[model samples]
Target: MTRTPSVSVVFVCHDGAGRILLARRSTRARDEPGTWDCGAGALEFGETFEQAVAREVIEEYGTGPEKIELLGVRNVLRPGSHWVAIVFAVRLDPAEARIGEPHKFDELGWFDPAELPSPAHSQLPETVALFT
Candidate 1:
C-alpha cells in the first residue's frame, strides 16, 4: 500500500516590523541539524489551519500568534517524505518568544530578512521568501 502525502503548517513569526524569528535545529532534529528554520508541525486530523499554526508557534516559541495570515502553499518532497505545506505569516511579541522545545531547537533569534543566518534549512529560504 502506498502512503499519502501529509499536511504541514509552516509559520513565519514576525514582530510587525522587519525581524523574523528563526530557530536552529538541534543535532537530534529529524533533519538538517544545525540549520535555522521557521516554526512548523504536522496538521492534525481535525484541526483548522489557523489552529495548527497557532499550536506550532506556541509549542516551538513559547508564544501565541497575535495575528495570522495565509501566505501561500508549497509542495515539499524528499526521499522518504512528501507534504503540502500551508505557509502563514504570523505576528507575535518577540519578547515572549523562546525555545520552547530545547530538545529540538538549540537557538532562537529575531533576524532581519536581508541578514538571515547562514546554513539555513534547505526549504526555509524559499518558504520565508514566499511571504517577503
Candidate 2:
C-alpha cells in the first residue's frame, strides 16, 4: 500500500523576548491528542505546501500571513507514515491574534523559549532551535 504524503507547518513568532506560540491539540484529533505542538496541519488535496501553511494559519489562528519568513523544511518519519513540514518564522502582533474556537485544539497560548511545554512533536524541537 502506498502511504499518503503529509505536509505540516510550524509557525514561530517572537518579540526579541523569547517566546513562541504553542497550541494544545484537541482530544478529537486522530493522533497525538492533547500534546503541545506548534501551529500545524496537513496539506489538503490540490493545495501547495505554502498554500496549506497559509490556510492552516487562518483556520487555526484566524490570521493571515503578513510577514512570514521561511525557516526550513524537515522530513520526519513515524512508525507508519512520513511527513515533510515547511517551518516558517512568523511575526504577529499579539493584539491581532485571537484564539479560534477549539475545533481542532483544546487550548492555545504563548510560551517563553526557556519554558516551553513538554511532549513536543513533528520536528518542533528543530523549529524552536532555529528560532532560539
Candidate 3:
C-alpha cells in the first residue's frame, strides 16, 4: 500500500463572542466517533487554504464564515494517517449552524471555550489553543 500525507483545512467557528462551535462525531465518522470536534476537510486539488475552509464550513455547518483568520499550522501524525493541518479561526452567525453532514456528525453545539464537551477529538486541545 502506498501512503501519502494530505493537507486539511481545520477550522473552529465562533460568534465573535466567547462561544465556539463543535460537532459531535457520529459512528460513521472517519475516526474518533463519539468525540467532540471542530470542522475539517481535505484540501481539494488546486484549491487554496481559504477556499477549502469556506467550502468545509458550508458543508459541515451549513453556514458561511463571516471572518476567517489564519491560526497556525501543524504536522498531524496519527497511527495510520498524517496530514498537514492548516488551522483557522472563523467567525460566523451562531443561529445558522446545523449538522450539515449527518453521516459524519450527529450533533452541533455552541459552547463556551472554557466549558467544552467531554471526550474531545485527539487534535482538539492543540487546535483550540490557537483560537486566540
Candidate 4:
C-alpha cells in the first residue's frame, strides 16, 4: 500500500500556565471537517521539516519564524496514511495573537492543558503530554 505522508504543527503558548491553541476546521475540508485540530499541512516536494512547520504556522496563524521553537516529532498512522507531525512551542502574547482569516479554521481559541475539547484528534492528548 502507498502511504500518504502529511505534516502537522502544534502551537503551545505559556502565560502564567500553558495553553494549547486549537482550531476548528472548516466543513469544506477534505478530511475531518468541523473537527478541532492544530495548525498543520502536508510536506511539499522540496521542503524540509522545519520549513514545512514554519510555512504551516504562517499560512494558518500568521506566525513568523522568530516566534516558534521546534519541540519534537510524532509519527501517527491512521487508516491509510501516516502523519509525521513536527511539534512546536511558540510563546505569544495572548492579547496580540489573533486567528487569521482565509484558512480552513473556522474558530480558534486557547485551551488549558488539561481541558481540551472533544472531536480533537486521538493523538492530541499524547502530543500535548510531551510539552508538560
| Ranking of predictions according to TM-score | 1, 3, 2, 4
Clashes of 4: 0
Q: RMSD, each candidate, Å?
A: 0.7, 2.3, 1.1, 2.7
Give the range of the ten consecutive residues with the poorest summed lDDT in model 2.
10-19
What lDDT would each prediction earn against the true structure? Answer: 0.93, 0.73, 0.93, 0.69
Task: Provide backbone clash counts, one per model.
Answer: 0, 0, 0, 0
- Runs off by more than 4 Å, candidate 4: 1-17, 101-103
> For model 2, what is the alpha-carbon lDDT of residue 26?
81
Candidate 3 local lDDT, 12-51, one digit each (tens)? 8999988999999999998899999999999999999999
Q: For model 1, where is the 10-residue window of minimal lDDT?
A: 109-118
What TM-score does candidate 2 get on C-alpha atoms?
Answer: 0.81
Q: Candidates' TM-scores?
A: 0.97, 0.81, 0.95, 0.76
Model 1: lDDT of residue 1: 82
lDDT of 4 by residue, 77-112 (tens): 888777787777766566654566545778878888
Model 2 residue pairs with clashes = none
How far does residue 116 in candidate 2 sit from its true spot (Å)?
0.7
Clashing pairs in 1: none
Per-residue error (Å), model 4, residue 51? 2.6
Candidate scoring better on lDDT of 3 and 4: 3
